[model samples]
Target: MKLLLDFLPLVLFFGAYKMYGIYVGTAVLMAATVAQMAIIYAIDKKLTTMHKATLALILIFGGLTLFLQDERFIKWKPTVLYTAMAVALAVALWVYRKNFLKMMLGSQLALPDPVWNRLTAAWVLYCLFMAAINGYVAAFFSTDAWANFKLWGYVFPLAFIVGQGIYVARHLSDEAPAEKTE
Candidate 1:
């Protein structure tokens, strides 16, 4: 459910692009992101910082794309977002001596400090790679190609997530024994 909600805007953007064009696709993306945020807030009663940041990026980049009549702004959005995440993770882990991934997922996942550090490092590197690839695609590809990449490139993240899950599962402990009813 959560995954679908998170991806709804992107799916809509791709569909709109296929049916209409980039400009109309950008408009649909902007509106869809706004709607997604609103729905998330309604359900969760508050938005996470990540959600707010993503919404801000979508609005800013999407607005510029429409206003300037150039698709470059939207094309660069993922690069900006991925780079920011990489920097934030690196800063939080090294400069501040904080493991943000652990902080965020500690309740659901249990791992040693070293494991958490490794996970954080992995995330930072992954984000950097994603940013670089998106930038390369945007700079070298045609707008139509870039748009297609935007939709198809979801595979990278999905694969990364599955790999991460597999890595984490190896270290995961079995559930605590259930208590017997009186």
Candidate 2:
């Protein structure tokens, strides 16, 4: 349910884009994101920092796209968001000596410090890679291509998440070790 809610805006934006155009798609994305936020608040009673950040970025970029009559702003939104996240993680891990990912998920996931550090590093790198790829697509390709990429490019995150899950699963202590035969 949460996953569907997360992708609702993007799906709507894709539909609106296919039906109308980029401008209409931007408007639809904004409205759908707002609706999603409202629904999430209604159900969860609180929004995470990620939700607020996504809302802010969408509103800002979508508004700019509409106001300027240019699709470039909206296209750059993902790159900007990914870059910001990478930067935040880098700062947290280096300057502050904090692992933001661990801080956020530590309560639910019990992993060694090394594993947490590795996971955080993986996320930071993944974010940077995502930002770079989005930027490349937005800059070198047509808006139509970029829009299509935006919709279909979800596979990247899905793959990353699966890989991360696999890595974490190996470290989970749910299974008992084999007994020695002696």
Candidate 3:
């Protein structure tokens, strides 16, 4: 459900881009992101961090899109948003001497801080790398190509992240026996 909530706005953006021009598509995406956020709030009775962060970016970029009447601003939206998140994660890791991803995802998976740091670094790097990739596509590729990447390219890394979590869990389990004996 959470994944669907995240994906729907991008889907709508692509659909709107197909059905209309970039301006209309950005408009539709702004509305769709709000609608999705509303639905998520109703389901959870509160906004998740992802929802808040996503909403912030959408509002900022949407306003820029509307105010400037330039689709290029909105086109750069994802790149900026993703880059910001990556920076935040990196800054949090440096300041706290801890991985923020572990704090965020700790309820679901319990692992050592060192392992969390590695995961966090990987996630941060991935986010930054994707930001660069998005920027490249937006600058050089067609809008349709960028939209396809936005929608379809998401699945691969998500699967890889899950696989990484599983690998970390297995490694932790192996260390558990040794720790118990000591």
Query: Could you tell me how far off, in angstroms, the CA of residue 116 lies in candidate 1 after the best superposition?
Result: 0.8
Q: Model 3, 157-182: lDDT tens per residue?
A: 78867988687767564332222243
| Tens digits of per-residue lDDT for model 2, 1-182 | 98999899999999999999999999999999999999999998999898899999999999999999999999999999999999999889989999988788876777788998899889999999999999999999998899899999999999999999999999977645434388
Q: Give the best candidate by lDDT.
A: 2
Better of 2 and 3 by lDDT: 2
Q: What digit string (tens of lDDT, one per residue) describes model 1 on residues 71-97?
A: 999999999999999999999999999
Which regions of candidate 3 are displaced past 4 Å? 171-182
Give the range of the ten consecutive residues with the poorest summed lDDT in model 2. 172-181
TM-score of model number 3: 0.85
Task: By lDDT, rank the candidates, best first.
Answer: 2, 1, 3
Please list all clashing residue pairs in model 3, or write none if there are none: none
RMSD of 1: 3.9
Which residue pairs in candidate 2 collide?
A: none
True-vs-predicted CA distance for residue 67, candidate 3, Å:
2.5
TM-score of candidate 1 to 2 decimals: 0.93
